[model samples]
Target: MLSIMFYIAITAEAMTAALAAGRRNMDWFGVCLIACVTALGGGTTRDMFLAHYPLYWVANPYVLLLVCGAALLTVAIARLVDRLRWPFLLLDALGLVVFTIVGCNIGMEAGVHPIIVIVAGMVTGIVGGILRDVLCNDIPLVFQGELYATVSIVTGVVYYLGLLAGLPADIVVLIALAVGFPLRVAALVFKWEMPRFVFDREMRK
Candidate 1:
């Protein structure tokens, strides 16, 4: 079940990223590149940090084809996708939580400390979006005072504790999704944002 959601989340991330590439007027190849980066960059980073050999996409090369295929399909149906903005936003939120859970699982498997596990989850959840925004020449959304990374952290904590409590793994996944997904949706719906520290003064020459 987790693997299935992972694939769906990857496809959704690629499609949304392809739309972002289109907004920047990137060519087809550029679109596919952005899609691949956005869909897989986070997991790649996590694996590298953990020194986990045979990165996920490298082990399953078909996933690259999956990302690129979804991207090109989005290109063909860009207008339809644009019209379904809310659905895509929900999918993106889902991707964040699912990716975080998967990363946390990997960290646990690597015998890392608990703190590192949560951080691993966070890196997986937000780094891909950060990379996408950077490539699109925008400030990364995770650094934009949104509730993004916080949601990932909260989800990871819940998932890890649930597992530590000896809950069934499947139930833990569902519980994490339940907690994280609605928190993100509420953040979006309510326009919730972290307070900013503004420093607008210019130094005298």
Candidate 2:
């Protein structure tokens, strides 16, 4: 079940990246590259931070192939996808939830502290989108006061607490996803945001 979720998450992420690439008028190679980065960047970063050997995509090359195929499909259906903006947002939200759960589990398996585990989840959930936005030359949504990163962190914390409460793994995963997906979608619909930092010019001096 977790493996299925992981595959869905990466495919959704790849599609999102491919759409962004198309928006930027990138070629097929560029689209595929961005898609892979968006799908795997977070996991790679999390693995590096944990000093885990053999990054996931490297260990399972099939994951890369999966992402590439998703990207290609996105390019082929780019117009249809563009017309279905809500579907993209929904898929992205789902991916965020899945990645958070996966990251949290990985951290726990690594025997990290609970707080660090939560942080690991947040990193894994958001870093891929961050890299995608950077490559696409847009301000990353997380930094723009969107609820994106907040949802990631909160989902991680919820999952962590669920484990501490001795919940079944599947139940914990479902609970985390249930909490995150609505929160993210509501935030998008309501334009919910954290207050942006504002530094006065004189403060800089």
Best by TM-score: 1
User: What lDDT score goes with residue 77 in model 2?
Assistant: 91
After TM-score superposition, what is the CA distance of residue 103 in candidate 2 from its true location, in Å?
Answer: 0.3
lDDT tens digits, residues 153-183, model 1?
9999999999999999999999999999999
The residue pairs found clashing in candidate 1 are none
TM-score of 2: 0.94
lDDT against the true structure, each candidate: 0.95, 0.91
lDDT of 2 by residue, 79-160 (tens): 8877888877888898888898889988998999999899889889999999999999999989989898899999999999
Model 2 local distance difference test score: 0.91
- Cα-based lDDT at residue 189, candidate 2: 97
